[model samples]
Target: MTQHFTAPDRLTAKTGTQWWRDAVIYQVYPRSFADGNGDGMGDLEGVRARLPYLRDLGVDAVWLSPFYASPQADAGYDVADYRAIDPMFGTLHDADALIRDAHELGLRIIVDLVPNHSSDQHEWFKRALAEGPGSPLRARYHFRPGKGESGELPPNDWESIFGGPAWTRTADGQWYLHLFAPEQPDLNWDHPAVADEFRSILRFWLDMGVDGFRIDVAHGLVKAAGLPDIGGHDQLKLLGADVMPFFDQDGVHAIYRSWRTILDEYDGERIAVAEAWTPTVERTANYVRPDELHQAFNFQYLGAPWDAAALREVIDVSLAAMRPVGAPATWVLSNHDVTRHATRFANPSGLGTQLRTPGDRELGLRRARAATLLMLALPGSAYVYQGEELGLPDVTDLPDEVRQDPSFFRAAGQDGFRDGCRVPIPWTVEGSSYGFGSGGSWLPQPESWGKLSVEAQSGDPDSTLELYRRAIAARRAHPGLGAGSDVRWLDAPEGVLAFARDGFVCTVNLTGRLVSLPLPGRALLASGPFTVDGDRFELPGDTTVWWTV
Candidate 1:
C-alpha cells in the first residue's frame, strides 16, 4: 500500500548555490518583445525601457534570444559576428546600457550563444569559400569531396534539421555541411582554433558584465565520429525525443566542462544554461553535471501530454535526473520556437504532429492557467515565455505569404508553423501594432488581441496577467513555494493531482466533475476560485489551488 501525504507543519531543505536555484526567468524574443526605436523590430533600447516592467513582474532574470550581428537567416540564430550587435537590433552601446539597466533593476541578463553554426556571410565561412576546396581554411568547417564518380552527390546522407539535405555544394565544387538552413554553416568544433575562438567569445561577453549565456544547440556541438549517415528519413521529426547521430554525443560534455571553468572565473556567479535536446531526461541532465552547465531546460516537461499521469511522470523523472547532478531542473512551457501553450494545451491532440487542430480556446486558457500554477508550485527554477502571462494564443491563421520560419517554407514534415508563436506582443488596445512600438510591428498581431492587451488587463483581478503576478508574489513570500525539490504525493482520484511541497499543499482537478475535499489550510492563491461548503471545498474542473499548512 502507498502512503498518502497530509498538510505538514515543517518544510524540506532548499539547497543550491547562486540565484538560479529557485529563480523565475522570463524569455524575451528581442525582435518581438518591443520596438524601442520605432523601427518595427525590438532592440536593445526596447529591452532597456522594459527593465522596470520585468522587475515589477518579479522575475529574477531575462533570457534574451539572439540579437547579435546576423543576416536574419534564421531570426538571428545564424550569427555573423558574435561580438557585434546587429544594426537592425541596435548599437553595441545600446546593449551595454540595457545590461546596466537590467542589472540595476536586480534582473540578471542571459543572452543567446549560437555555437553550433554561423551565418554563411561570417568572415570565417567567407574565407573558407574563397580559399577553394582543399585550403586549410576549409578545415574549420565540414568540407568534403563528393561521393559520386563526378563528385556530384553529397558525402553523407544526413538530413538538415530545417529540412532537405544537410550538404550544400559551394562554387568551388566541394560540399559543406549545414545541419539547418543552407545559409547557416556548421562549424568544426574538433579544430583547436574553433574552440579557442569560442572561449574568447565567452570571455568577451563575460567581461561586458552580462549575467549568463543561453547556449543554443548545446548538445550538437560535437557530432558522432566519421560523420555517419543516419540512413533514414524524417530526421528532424525525431528531435528531442529520439537519438540521432548529430546530437547528444558524449564529446559535447568535454566542451561544456571547459566552459564551466570559465563561468566559475566570473564574480557574479555567472551561469550557462543549455538549450539541449537529448533522448532522455537523464541524458539531458549530463549537460548540467557538477563540472558542466548550471542548468538544462526540461524539454520533456515542455512536450509532455496534458494529462495528469504524463505530467507526474515527467516531473518525477526530471527531478530524479537532476538530483545526482545537483543542478536545478529548469521548467519551460513555451518558447519562441514552439507553439504557445495556450493553443497547444487547448487542442484535443497534444502531440506536435497535430499542433494546429481547431480546439476550444476557452478551455485552453483555463487549462493553461492551471498548468502554470502547477509548474510554479514545484521546486527549482521556472521560465515564463514572453507574452505567456498575457495568455496570448498562437496566431495560427497567419497568411502563407508572410510566414518566415524555414521549416514552414520547407513544407516538409514538421509540427506546425512557428510564426504563429512569434507575433509581436500587444501592449495596448488602442494603438496600431498594439503599442509594441511607435511603428508597425515586424510580424502582424491579431486584431482580436485588444482584449488581452496589457492595458486592457492591467487592473483586472481575473486577468491572466494578474494571476501570474499574484502567483509569483506568493512564491516569493511563501516559504513553501519555490523552495525545495522534494514533493510528497497525495492519494487522489483519477484525473486529479495532489502534492505537498514543504508546508504548501497544491491540488489540481483535471476531471470534468467537481470534487469536494477538506481544506488543508487557508488558501494563499488559486488558478480559479472554488466554492466552500462548510469544512469542505468544491474544486471545479481545470482549477489549481495552493493552500498553506
Candidate 2:
C-alpha cells in the first residue's frame, strides 16, 4: 500500500470558490476517459495525462464520474467502498496524482459521491448477513421481516429502477430490499450509524484536499416507513415505492450541515451538486436553497420539445420556480443520460418525414451554434456534455449487441433509454480505435465522431468548437449569467426563442427555412441571415444568432 497524500495541512486561495461556479465542467467516464496501463480501460492516470486538454477548454472544473470501489454495476454507482479507489480505475496513489495535476492545470476536481447505495459485496453488508438478528452490525442497515412468518412474499410491493421486484429473498430466508439492481442494496439513511459513516466519508475526502462532491441521486437517501412493499401490494407488486418521505429525509440535511461546518472550518467552500429527479421547479429548488445544495440540475431544458414556444414556456417556468428560494438552476441541454442536442434539436425530425436524405447533419453545425447561444446566453449556469461542444452526433444506429446499459436489459427496449449517449468518445479521425488508444476501448467509439475530435475542430475558426468557445467567452464577459440577474423573454414568434438579459437580447432560429428575423437593435454577431428594423430574423435550418437591443 502506497500513500501519495496523507492529509493536507491547509487548503488555500490558489484553489478558491470561483473554481467551481464560474467553471465549465468536463465529465469523464473513467472506463471511457483514457487508458493508463494499456489494459483497454480508462483509469485515473489516464485522466491525469489529459488534464491539459480540459484547461484549454477554458473550464474552471472537471467532474470526473464515479471511480470509487464498486462492482461495476451501473458503471460504478454501486459503491463497495467509499475510501479506496477501484483497482480497475487504478490505485489511491493515482487519484492523488490526478488531484495534484488537475489543480496544477488550473482545473478544480469534483468526484461523484453515490451515497444512495453500496455494492452488496461490501464487507459490512456481508458481516450483517453472516450475523443476522442479534448482530450489532444489523443495526447499520434497514431490517424488516417478510410479508408472512414463512417469508413466502416480499414485505411490500415495490419495483426496482432496473425494472424488477425491489425485494430479493436472502438465501438464509430473510428479505433485503434493493431499489435498483439486486447487487446494489439501498443504504438505510434512517440508521444513525449510516449517517455517522457518511459524515466520516466527508471528512476523509475533505481532509485529502479534494474539492467537493456531486451527490448522486440526492432523492434516494431515505426509505418509506414500515419498509412496506410498493403501494397496496398484498401480492406480487412492482415499481417505485412510497420512499419519498424517507428518501430526502430531514436527517440528510443534518449530515450536509455537518459537512458544511467542516468545510467552513477548513476555509474551503465545498459545493454539493445534487443529482435529483424532482421535475417540478419548487421541489428541485428546495434541494439547493442556500444551506442545502449549491446547485441542483434543472433538466427541463433537456427534454423541452424543439420548438420556440415550448422552450420559452420552460424557461419561464424554471425562472419562476427556482428564483423564490434563491437556488441557482443549472440549464443542461445534454448529459450522459439524454440524446445529444445535435441529434435532438439540430436534426429536424420532421424534415426526415419529407425527404429521404436527411439534411440535419449539414445544418447541425448552425443549429448547435444557436443552441449554444441559447444556453450560454441565458441567465443560469450552463452545463455542456463531453462531446456536445464539439458537435458530436449521437450514435443513433448502434447495433443491439454493442449496447451495454442495464436499463436496456431491464426494459428490453421499452423506453429506448440512453443506449446511444453512452458510446465512447472519438479523439481522432482514423484508427482501429478512434485514437482513444493503441488497443480497443471498453465501449466502441461513435463512428460519427470521426470528424469531431477536439484536436480537429479546435484549430478551425468556423468549427462548432470555436463557436462554443465564443459563446462561453461571451458569457464570461457578461456577469449576470454566473451571478443572478432577472431574465425577460423578448416578443419573438415560433421557431425563434428570444430573450433579454439586462439589455442584451438573444434570439435563436430553430427552423429549417431561411426566415428573416427583425434586427431589433445592432447585429453584434450573426450566424444566419435576417431582416432589419424589427427583431424578426430568418433562422435557417438549425441556425442561431445573438445581439443587444
* Residue 109 shift from truth in candidate 1, angstroms: 0.2
TM-score of each: 0.96, 0.87
- lDDT (tens digit, per residue) of candidate 2 on 227-298: 543345432121112224335444566656665665555434667787876536666777776667777777
State residue 252's C-alpha deviation in candidate 2, in Å.
3.8
- For every candidate in turn, the CA RMSD to the true structure comes to 6.3, 4.7
On residues 1-549, what C-alpha lDDT tens digit does candidate 1 reach at each position?
Answer: 111122111111111246788889999999999899998988888888888888888888899999999999899999999999999889889988887777666778899999999999999999889888777878888998889888899989888877778899987779999998899999999999899999999988888878789999999988888899876656766777777778998999999999999988876678999999898999999999999999999988998877889889999999999998888887889999888888888887455623665368998899899999999999999999999999998998888888888777664636448888899998899886888899898888888888898888887999999999899999988888885678898988888899997789999998857998887788888888898878889999989999988
Which regions of candidate 1 fall more than 4 Å away from where they truly are?
Answer: 1-17, 413-416
Residue 148, candidate 1: Cα error in Å is 1.1
Off by over 4 Å in 2: 1-21, 229-251, 346-366, 411-419, 521-537
Error of 2 at 378 (Å): 1.6
Candidate 1 local accuracy as lDDT? Answer: 0.86
